[model samples]
Target: MNVEIPYFARHQLSPGGTWISSRQKSLRTFKLADIGEGITECEIIRWAVKEQSAVQSFDPLCEVQSDKASVEITSPYDGVIKQFLVGEGEVAKVGQGLCLIEVAEDDTTHVESTETTGQSPVKTPVQVTHDVAEDTPTEAPPSVNVPLRKHPLDPTNDLSGTATTDHVLATPSVRHFARQHGVDLAAIAPGSGRDGRVEKKDVEAFISKVPVPDEVETASRQQEDVVVDLGRTRHGMWKAMVQSLEIPQFGYSTSLDLTRIHGLLPTLNAHIPAHFLPSASTPSSPRISHMVNPSALYPVPQPPSVPESGRFTKMTYLPFLLKTLAISMMEWPLFRASITPAPAQDTNKPTLTIRPTADLTLALSTPTGLYTPTIPSAQSFSLHALASRVTHLAYLGRQVPCGLTVKDMPRRGGTISVSNVGAIGKGEGASPVLVPGGGVAIVAIGRAKWVWDVSDEFYRPNDDGMEGERRLKIDVSWSVDHRVVEGAELAAFVETWRGWVENPERLIAVAT
Candidate 1:
């Protein structure tokens, strides 16, 4: 069945939710909620529904681009999509309405509330209405009722139970989000929103200062484990990274003489220009701030021999590689699919084959675990467009927005991934593990070095025909989904990438 997903709407929904109390009717619009723990707003990039299309409650309704990721906004209530208040690339603040949906009237309704003090009100009893499913395991209410703000000294009170457990069972990213929100792990209660999942809302009401109920910790030997939280971007990456590990892994890499990228640097600099080479310490700048200032703080001068390629293009090589990957993935749709929901009817369990209109949810790691700021489509995105996205996300990683709602990455669609370790000098073989939900591939780019080849190689200039040749040796590792991508095709993919670097113009065709 073809479902119509309109990018925009010509009308708003009539306020009739009050009348649909007894029907399986559609209701008013519901905006995108807090999907990540630290995310404050997101740009609506695509709509999965139009003004009048029936949608399943959990069906992907819209794709949202947060500072952390580009994820589909699932319908919180099942109904017909009645209207759209936001459009593609339009930034919507947290809790802003994005669309309306009419739902089947049921005994259940969303109960919103908040705590009374400098603590979370997470344990406020919520009527659980959802059951665990592969797509949405821990379902929540339509909207969380945020308590009207209160003060510690305010004479307001509720008998809301306090959070008692310090170590809650949640993904590392969720744990971090709880901390970022000032959710005290010691207060409130743990209710697995799905299959007993203590979801984001449960954590929101939890606080570290809540008194321990009945001294449960003193009764058990508590092993010490420092919890690290993976935020939305990291959670997404964790899901994808795991998918890549279960497959047969392979890697093929070759340095693009870099001669052309190096060559193009001079011209590109004359037209645009760059500040410096990017590194771990590079400060991502607008993306990551807090670094020394070039004018006042550093008191440094541009190196006289700084080549434009090294100064500008060199800064963007890996991202271009990602663009190169996006082109390949578009040509090979199998790479972006998840393999869990196989067709039992087929001889070979058919993995889910997807052709994403956008592949911008790629993530990188940080101290907090993993994070990704949405990058635009790789195929037609300009270098500036790509660079700007990378820079912004890199900084957001450091900024760590508070009060953002985050959930554990459910095992699902992971197109592909890259892990770069080449900046220091030499490549090292890495066993990047699979993140526990879903994902099929991860590429680890190792160090770089020059090798000497002694022979009258016809591939070189005549002046160096009989001399020892210096060629850069680069290591590339590919982690694949054994469920779908096989070793041979995986090798071919890497080989094709290798060939592109071997001949830089090959990249231009894709770049243009």
Candidate 2:
């Protein structure tokens, strides 16, 4: 049932009937309002409201801490608070409601005696609804200038008055969030409720609180509106990233031998649990008979299966790929940089301004989802050091809740990406996706399969440490920003990756 609130403000939601209440809607649903100039997301760090607390409109609801700064959102209308949409430490996007309130209806008849005690003219709160004409959505509240002033005090007595900005009349918290977003405190009308305090509720009444009587709001008007499903924070991120297309892109691909990486699986299974296991899994855990008998039956004491992520201690392909990324990046310093659109470059797409550093971005795809966490720019060192870093990042990626099957992590802002399709048993020749955000190049790897030794023991020991000539096709696919790095430079990077993987010992030798 739609819980009828005594009064409701525009854009503010109440217990929205069944579809909402059954889902347990709150009385005052204060969604993320357009806080300050074009800010899309904020981190919800603390709540100013709690269950059953009495509240007035524009009262501070909670602190929405953002990347730039933190601001406490105020309640829009006078009401009693009931619930909140997000938890602490979680992030909320712009326009998403934060809390719920129950507006008390028609309180004009019951003004408290205290409200009448002051000679300061008691202005009645008139509720004006912005009705949508039949088939159109109402525009955001108008930005009218609301007049603010100090109360009339002993006019005849000469008293020393304090001098501060007009915002001094506003609550400290209100001024803080406002200042964090560059909102002019003087522009907001003073609270007529009591003591001229600028409560959170006043902030929500965009037009009513304007200093100038004519309600002419200065906010940009919308021509049309489209909903953002993942919220504007995610949308903003997506938009900001795509803007880098002015930087040119190029790609290169090559075949890679992984037989050596394959050889290490048996040992990995023996020592490591299944959790740490990469995409490929072997049925090595066969049931063995119990040597000791319990009562009348020989109960086999079974342990848990291998950890899904396997173990970090064991040598895996992650280390090898990581080492290659780091070692190769040393020669490509531009890749290691994070500053936007090389300083010397113009807005137009050009090939010359890119850096040479190989700031690596690892793109690992699993049954669960895709993850492309940065390997930090210019992270170059010996192969062993690279191995250490690779293992750490790989383990960290696995722990990311979004990286699992439920949520597919979005990958962006990486110079080079390494996606291991090999884990899913695909051996050789698989093309990975070119993540939209100017992601220049990507490397696809396949499973280490055995190849026949026809050409002078072609399948020699590579990185995974397995001996014996296991014939395997080396599958490596690379995509680049064709403008900056040429076809040959991309080729050279791959050639280096391939060479290191093939002569794993050479990497080890130099690293040592």
Candidate 3:
């Protein structure tokens, strides 16, 4: 019953003399490369290469999203994509094989000796329980109509019945079966199946055991359950937050009298450099004319080094606050110090590394996640220069696509972090967390609210009875690691900060 087959068809066969194609073709697994510093994993945003499609070296294969930004991965060899190990919308660890590429004998530059010697590496097929089929036809090309299986961790994955607080491990078929019978998968207990994956039989058995509910009863049963898997950035935040729980922290709260600083803002804003201002300026803007007349407000000195572009034009309390914070840290050296465990050579005692300059981390909240961009050597920059840098960093953080990169968050981030909680709302105080690697001390700046002062009694005689004037004051809450800093030193440190905050003119002197 042997029938003569065509030469092309014979070459495609898996057995007999047709093994030449198999011998010449080699499968190489391409692993994910390190896209950014400190990034452990990334989510596959999209696949550029299709299964069995020919691709040249350096061609874009896929796009992966890291905490910093979305990056494209390219091919290293001239080959055809065999299969994707980690599907789109799924998280893949750094250094894990992303996909298998089938390379021709002549094209594989440095393929393993085993692969080139007619012996192919054995690969076990990954078990796919999802609705989407993993296998693609070897002969047929990829089709646009083919629907991809929605990843279990995908945020947009639809929920049919009551959304489960926990992830339901049922297969697509089981889920479909449950849906048809109006069965809620979340109510069923985990089955005795492998990895506790709920089988179709498990769903059926559960449905059979439960009594049927009326339409009214089903309608009245509110489904309040929701399930959301944390993205890479958010997950990292969670881990960092959990690590902070191990540190012994203490809090100190005080108010910053912004009476003088507030009055100085109008003058500082007028002196902002033209280079930092927006391109479309207001025709009658007084700020523009005052740029040339910098002598009026004590010329806003240019920074030692300015970024290619500065985003801040108008000065605010933040730039002043940052300036003073940096100055205070410089005066009190301990505030600029971080305690580290003993080096490997000397395991008996711990070590303290005190930075010469004050590196400040500004806690900025973004849509993606919380980022603390470091302003290295904040004391080195003038008030105007520091304001520009802070504005630039904030601009990067607030970009629609998030322009913040790994360089923005230096590895040796400051020994202190500042969270301007007051800028957002009327919060009186906040107990900010001292992130493990972030710093030893963190401060939360609350909104400046007008408060009546009664200190006039001390200055004036008891008989002179004069009502105290209203002063705009802000609350500054401090959280410090108890292991490194003592209460008295922290209080004394706060007193020094208070002195600078109360008299912000000292900041200009210090900066000069």
Candidate 4:
């Protein structure tokens, strides 16, 4: 009897009389999944896998740039890439097809038509991987043929003869370093780094050992200027700064005495709670009680413990300044207010939305870019807790591609922003700019220095009575939205802040 064979099972008989079943290849389009925080689209920065290349599940596919962060997209299927629907430097919307993958189908039940569902092929939910180009290691590009040249150190001319460094393994940062120094990576082949990877030290060593000829040095100096595109972060800043011009702002400059805080810093550092110390594994130290105390009566409260991200061995004046600012913010409601636009019906009647809690934004400069991460409800936190939070925020900012997320930066930013320019330079004064929605005001704190105060109001006559007392002071400049905050109000607010700063003991009195 003759029987009909299944489509998948149908096979051809070889010359050896052996039946062979053919594996059919089906085309499937891999779509871009939704990356969080209401992001609609992302720019394809770089592709990790090439077209027609085979990839395994969980293999990195491409890196995309969003407004907030850079995320690495990974493949969800084990297949060969058939075609790239979207190229690098192009923006792809969510749910859009990224590439066509060719998957093998062996059984009739598993066979699928060559059609796309227009949905992400990722089996599991998409997750954001913040591995920037610098952090992610990738294979070198194709090598280029170059004319042979002799090296002073290598008499055989084998080590630094040709510029075939395209195959040399190095990170994007190391490559940038080589470019900046005008050194060919191929000349420094067989890098001393692990697994023959080129490192910054390797580039430095190459620069130190390889002496450049006067002719070549002159040619390098006369090289053509190269046009470079601004990164996503810098581009965003450019737009924000442009928009800031529409807002009316006024600048206020003043100096604060920090001698008292400087004197108190050593005591504060020495008395940092054990729980907040980085070396402390446990929350609290063991305490022995001479007499038994009831849970209801004479109850001893446990001290707050610091998270790993917020742990610190020593304290600085910045935290004290932040705490004092929070107190001043609580006292002055206008500083804690955000401007809300008027309703559609009433275009002229805008309102100020005063937040009950004191939210503070800190201007942090990272390798990636400038980020203003907020510390919500700063008034509720004690001095130690405030310091821990600041430490945690800074740690997040320092990470590669930056660890700061939407959580670190909320929709409604801090009503007031602070930038510690003093940490970097010795500038005594600055004219800080204020951007719309950046809060009502922004302050730049400059370096602290000792200055002789001739005013009799602050200092009393010493034993000599001939010279004035020396005071440690720091310069602070404020730029406030003049549309909302009057110049007098800004001065009055600064004076109120000075009260808390001058008498930091009040912070300890009201410690949580």
lDDT of 2 by residue, 36-61 (tens): 44458767867877877887645667
User: Candidate 1 residues 1-512, lDDT tens each?
Assistant: 11121211211111331111112232565756556556688877678778889887457778776655455666655567767888875789987888766555433322122221333222213222222122311223255677643211112323244333323344344656777666654443455554344566677555444566565674553555657655445665656666645455444433443444555555544443334443332433463345645577566666434322223333446655666667776676666665555466875665465747335444555554555333434566655445545554455554433111222121233456556666544645665544423345667776655566554642455474555666655566655656467778877776666555656567655544
Q: Is candidate 2 or candidate 3 better by lDDT?
A: 3
Structural similarity to truth (TM-score) of each candidate: 0.45, 0.43, 0.59, 0.62
Predicted structure 3: lDDT: 0.72
Task: Show the colliding residue pairs in model 4.
Answer: none
Best by lDDT: 4
TM-score ranking, best first: 4, 3, 1, 2
The local lDDT score (0 to 100) that residue 114 gets in candidate 1 is 22
User: Worst ten-residue run, lDDT, model 2?
Assistant: 16-25
Task: Point out where model 2 deviates above 4 Å.
Answer: 1-106, 109-121, 124-251, 258-313, 334-339, 342-346, 349-358, 366-369, 377-413, 436-438, 453-470, 509-512
**What 10-residue stretch in candidate 4 is worst by lDDT?**
123-132
Least accurate stretch of 10 residues (summed lDDT) in model 3?
Answer: 1-10
Candidate 3: stretches off by over 4 Å: 1-224, 282-309, 345-348, 456-466
Model 4 lDDT tens row, 370-482 = 88999999989878888899999898888754667667887689999999999999998998888888999999999889989878766676788756778889999999999
Tens digits of per-residue lDDT for model 3, 332-377: 8888897787889989888778989999999998765788889988
- The C-alpha lDDT values of all candidates are 0.51, 0.51, 0.72, 0.76
| Range of the 10 consecutive residues with the lowest summed lDDT in candidate 1 | 2-11
TM-score: which is higher, 3 or 4?
A: 4
